[model samples]
Target: MTASASESGNTVAAVDLGSNSFHMVVARLQGGELRVVDRIKTMVRLGEGVDARGRLDPAVRERALEALDRFGQRLRGLPRGSVRVVGTNTLRVMRDAQGFQAAAESALGHGVEVVSGVEEARLIYLGVAHSLGDDGQRRLVVDIGGGSTELIVGEGVMPLHMDSLEMGCVRLARQCFPKGRYTPRALDRAALRVAQELEPVARRYHNAHWAQAVGASGTVRAVQAVLKGLDLSPDAITLDGLLRLRECLTRAGRESSLDLPGLDADRRPVFAGGVMVLLGVFQGLGIQRMVASDGALREGVLHDLLGRMASRDVRDQAITAMMARYHVDAEQANRVSGTARHLFGQVRRAWGLDDEAEAWLRWAAETHEIGLDIAHGSYHRHGEYLARHSDLSGFSSQDQAVLAALIRCHRRKISRKALDAVPDNRRLRVERLIPLLRLATVLHRSRLDDALPAVALRRRDDRLDLRFPAGWLEAHPLTRADLAEESTALKRLGLALRVR
Candidate 1:
């Protein structure tokens, strides 16, 4: 679910369950500016031992749960809509994320959103752009995490291109130097390997492409500290600084004996791996100087939540754009949205539906016919695909999945199997919303410029009765026919629809 906007926007929080660390920032909104009130972070290294088969190790899971429990305690008494939680690359790779996400969300006060790689890059760019001055330079922002690397090219508040690659400090450390030993040959091999991985990404990020390069995340901060210690450059990382740092570190040959100033002990094991990744980035992209950006994905999530609280909801705009692109009739969509919301209000409590579930149904109703431009047949399927894959700006990946499923089930034989395939928590929600969508479609089948009759809802053991005004259904023959057809549609879901 996106988020319920609070009319009196007071406070907002964002929790980033990152691969290398977990962070929570709570802030108060005053005079349209965010004032930081509280901040917390822990070096969980959550991506530490996720294997090729997408299983999180037992130790890693325990660490993540303990950290989330602590965060949960801190989030006590916060309003429901005030906090937004997001999971980064590690959650993206976890095959069984339900157990962990459920536990985490229980500790926190809201559901956890595991976004796509591109979405992560987009948020990182947003945080960077908001933090920095309006220098008007097209910047290349890099965030190397525990399991993924995000590269974004943008200027001002907009991003032109964004990509997330499978390269990071924790993953690299495990693959290259599992014993925490620093050797010239080992470092050389790691850097070359990272460079090789970048071969596909380097061509697109050539020097001519972006004016300035900015680094984000802990890996970059450690590199900056090592460079500042060497008296090389306090503001930006240079190629010479990297080469010199590698030489000095190689002399020590082990993490324990490294004599670099400002190197935190917690960062020791992954420091060598981070440096090698940086060296590869410099060599592959010809980057001479790179500065660190304090802002990252977590802050961007907060800003996005704030936008929703205001009236400028991006999901609404995205729906309008999708309808326009697919040539869905605006009048019909409005009609459906009206009926869907009316029906939702009628049975929300009976069906165990919440505000978030209601909002999703409304969104689906407004854009269900979005694939008619492709072809009328299987348009629902096409629309589902578009909703699933499109770069929907305001929606998290989970939001997209729910919206797409609602659309897919709107006209088809009620796909109980498909509903089962979704996350368990959402299966019942989809089941409940599909009936509302189907009924709304039936009410608006005439597609006429006329208002629908006031309807009431009543629930039986396993069936629903959609009662229209006493004589309204009898007077409208076409609506009667539509209801008859709807009966067949509802029957497929083991549900019976009665028209009164």
Candidate 2:
């Protein structure tokens, strides 16, 4: 896909490969607001397909692929950046997720991003905040998926505290109610286990922090429906209402034979387990009531896409925050960014680098020195550590990996092994961009505002030829020597850099 196609689309779509269900939302941008045009959701029970060994069952893989094929049909003709697809907890935990991801991408005709749990929490908050309107009240948003539960506290659209618990409905169901029977003992065990999981973060989410509690995801929506249908709660999910629903489930005994009011047949299988998780959340966090939100990860994804299209990307804000936290030199960062952008423009077309690549490069260039905050010695490694492990909002797991790789290799010795560690499809791009970043950084090593002479860069197969104006190299002998040394480093990575 061309850069133009990615940036110039009115229609956008988001696909969430959730643990229990796969969901896709297509929205149209009109009057600066997203209008939902289509939504598709299918219960694939993706979490249930993973065994104790974390390997995805073949049958489950087939179900997931079939579902993606269907989603692919709806997503056809969407521009490259017009669509964003994310894989959640089940894919995160799968031992062989790469295999599934590759197949899924093929089925969907787009790349799939596997986001970190904290990032997932942020997206959930974004969805909930946009859906609930801008009341300016701090909210506690909880999302219970098939394999994980995300808890977030935020005001407006910014998430202040976020956490992703390892427990979820499908996981709890598999562990405690494998036989499909909802015995009191099983319910007790599930709730107790969930409570134990929430114990550490319970105090952080107590009533004092947030104005109101909100729930997003199918489990909570189903629970709210059941509560209203049973007349336990008219418009909200309350502790007492959840307890009553628990009693009814216990009375029903088995999930398959159980019939409940306002419960969809599709949700019946995981309904009991979902209730157990919500019960744990309510009891552990001391939440009296939680109102359901119509939006979730999918909506959040769309809104984030919109932000990117509108140049209000949270990622830029996140990078800025990181810079502030690390005390990065803004002037130096801007210099490096400017130099990198100039170099990128010279070779982007030849190297097939898109706007996304340029964006990553610019962000890396701006924040590559973050590790200096920790210590000057081996700061690049420190920077890489922070970039890879930190809970950076708006960045997917893959984004972190690539960004970290670039930072790790931005200075000192450039290692092919480090570049090889990046995602398979992105290795070449990282390799191409690393030299550009290194050159840019080297040019600004003096941190001076002196005007730089125009330099030309051309790529020929595995070789990069760099030509500077006459006498520029001699006038800047230090830069010349740096370029000479960089040539050797490039050779180690199987690339030839010719400086003239």
Candidate 3:
């Protein structure tokens, strides 16, 4: 669901749950143009608490919730789907992530989505590109976060290549600058680690690929500021200034002693780590200088959300591409899609579905047979795997789970485990959705476009009565057997499928 300017909410807010800080941006869309209204950021150092078991420490968890409590209050009165809260790095790799996500959503009064690292690079590019507003120069955008760093090279607003590396401020600082102490040896070791991280992808993002270099997010901006404070390359980050800053840090010998212009107290602990990454990036990518941008993940999310509100959803394009890639039978997919939509109209209200459900049905109908390219036997499972694991731009992890579940249970015995994979709140609606998709596929098993008689569907709680034209079932024995088999499958999901 996307927010629209036509709706009561001309105001849209994007909240970025970063490992280092929680940032929120509220913008108003008026006459198709976005205007910034409010922005707030709070440092939480969430990555610091991730243990070997992948759990957030209890104290860190409490601190995170407290920060979310404040963010949620600011988002008060915003309509659902208008406020987008995205989690990066920490949330993506955390153990029991679903549990934390649910609690976070409760506090924020909005759904929270964790994007893949590659997707994170894409969003960061979206934000930086929009801020720059397409100068026609190919640019390399770099964003260093607490637990990860993203490098994106793009022309105008479209990113051509992207990479997200494991090196980040918090993780690296903990490794190389513990107790806020940075020695010459420690800095060199950190530089080496950053090099190894970039070794494979550095060439692809080197100077030859992009005409200009731009940095986004907190760490990069801080580095740009510190260079000016020291009066060493006051305009942008030059390699010489970065090296000078490294020397300054080694001379201080401790985070407490290091003092420079534009270095905030909160940043001191992780400052050395961020600088080391910048140094390695410069050396590895042959960068002479780099400037900073006001845009980052939060802004990118706003623009992406705006695109969604305007109905330019990237997920639609992703589904279309998947269909072509997997060699789906276009005609058969069309038949199933049409029937599913038809069935949906009858049961939507009764089953508590909305526009989002319609979208799920359409996508499921179009891509249901994708697994046929892999093999006919258990094609449903193959389709599920594709939906579950593929990097479908703009589809959240929860969104993928829902799509996967629908495809998995479209035929044969419904996979209870597949349905269970869907988030708790939306599980029931997906269960109801499965039977409708199954019915569509069952009706079109012959894969002929000869057109069947109009079928009417009525729903009463968990029971769905599917009525065909008079004598239609008797005339089509094969479809009847298909429905009989479907009835058994529906029983497992606690749904009744009565065909008369």
| Clash number by candidate, in order | 0, 0, 0
Total clashing pairs in model 3: 0
Winning candidate number (lDDT): 2
- Return the TM-score for each candidate structure: 0.90, 0.95, 0.96
Give the candidates in order of lDDT, highest first.
2, 3, 1
The predicted structure with the larger lDDT, 1 or 2, is 2
Cα lDDT of model 1 by residue, 201-314, tens digit: 898887789999999888999889878887888878998999888887689898788878878888887888788888888888889989999888888888878877775666
Top candidate by TM-score: 3
lDDT of 1 at 94: 89
RMSD of 2: 2.7
* Candidate 2 accuracy as lDDT: 0.90
Better of 1 and 2 by TM-score: 2
Model 2, runs deviating above 4 Å: 1-9
Q: What is the lDDT of residue 213 in candidate 3?
A: 97
Q: Could you tell me the TM-score of candidate 3?
A: 0.96
Candidate 3 per-residue lDDT over residues 173-248, each given as its tens digit: 9888877788888888999999999999999999998899999999998998888888888789999998998899
Which parts of model 1 are misplaced by more than 4 Å? 1-9, 183-185, 254-257, 324-329, 348-355, 446-462, 469-478, 491-495
lDDT of each: 0.83, 0.90, 0.89
